[model samples]
Target: MTRAALVTGGNRGIGRAIAAGLVARGVKVTITARDRAEGAEAAEALGCDWALADLLESDSLRQFDGAPFDILVNNAGILPSGSLLDNPQGYFDCMAVMVDGPFRLTLALAPGMIARGYGRIVNLSSGWGAFAEGLGGPNGYGIAKAALNAQTLALSQELPGNVKINAMCPGWVRTRMGGPGANTSPEDAADTAIWLATLPADGPTGGFVRRRRRIDW
Candidate 1:
């Protein structure tokens, strides 16, 4: 069967790699990014569909006219600089993408998957999200990701067991957000994501995973 997959922030970074991997597997992939040019170019390069969306805009996503997908990968996120105290507004900015957007999208799309008796959801999380690293302060990005992990677990339980849902901690990939000298490549980070996406109906759910090993959540 031809499976459909949607990946957010697919213009670049780990999201791009995950989308490419899915396309390589012959999945009909749709990638979403905020930038039209980048999103279009990436989609063209990968021979996939592209949708322009700023996940923060709930109405924008809600009003989006698109085909229902069998798989949804919430790979979009942002990292604003500065400490939590210095960047108070950063919390809202981060939550808009990481928490609010994924929550709404998952809620909107899940019923279809349940009705069909199969679905795959990959909610991208972070190692920092597992616990309070001294690195992650009250910053919006960190907190939102942590909260996102919780949401992933909660949502997984609500879905049919055949609809496998899991959170992915991609490690520290060498993206613009990860900065220079980051150890993991987008390709490496994407491995677990693609693996989770293509799982069998009896696969695990409500788990936090990296390389298939359950993480502390």
Candidate 2:
């Protein structure tokens, strides 16, 4: 049977590349973006589908109806600037997008995935989130990603045998957040996410991976 997949923040950059890769693999892909025009344009470019979803708002999440997706790539995120003392609102937005949205979306989709006895969930996490790696990003960014990693681990245990969940650090990719000086390309960073989204039943779960190799989280 053909697989259906959903990618968040897929209007551009790494998310867009992952969506394109999934579409190339014959998965029926749906991407979520806050802007309708941009989302539609990206969807058209990828030859996939698009939905309006803003991860920052609970109401926006409630409006999304993308269940029945066999694979889910929670790639939507933001890099909140400033230190802990400076960016309270940015911190809130970061947590909303990186942690709360994925948590709720996973809760919503996991049931269908469990019932179908098949699923792959990939959370785009960061090395900055890892305790072993010293939680290196901006104030809210690392904390949110750490929570996301925890979410991945927790869900992996709760999910059924055939279903798998994992977190991955896409590395420093040349995306809007990553900046022009970043070393990795969008397509290169997308590789691990695409791999995680299409993992076999036997693939490792509850793990943090970079370039498809397991890493400390």
Candidate lDDT (C-alpha), each: 0.86, 0.91
Per-residue lDDT, model 2, residue 118, is 92
For residues 114-148, what per-residue lDDT tens digits would candidate 1 score against the true structure? 77877999999987787834326346776888899
Candidate 2 CA-lDDT value: 0.91
Model 2 Cα RMSD, Å? 1.0
Output the number of the lDDT-best candidate: 2
Query: Stretches of candidate 2 above 4 Å error?
Result: none
Backbone clashes (count) for model 1: 1
lDDT of 2 by residue, 19-132 (tens): 999999999999999999999999999999998999987788775454788888999999877987887887888899999999888888888888898989899999999999
How many angstroms is residue 56 displaced in model 2 relative to the true structure, after the best TM-score fit?
Answer: 0.7
Clashes of each: 1, 0
Report residue 111 deviation for candidate 1 (angstroms). 1.0
How does each model score on TM-score? Answer: 0.94, 0.97
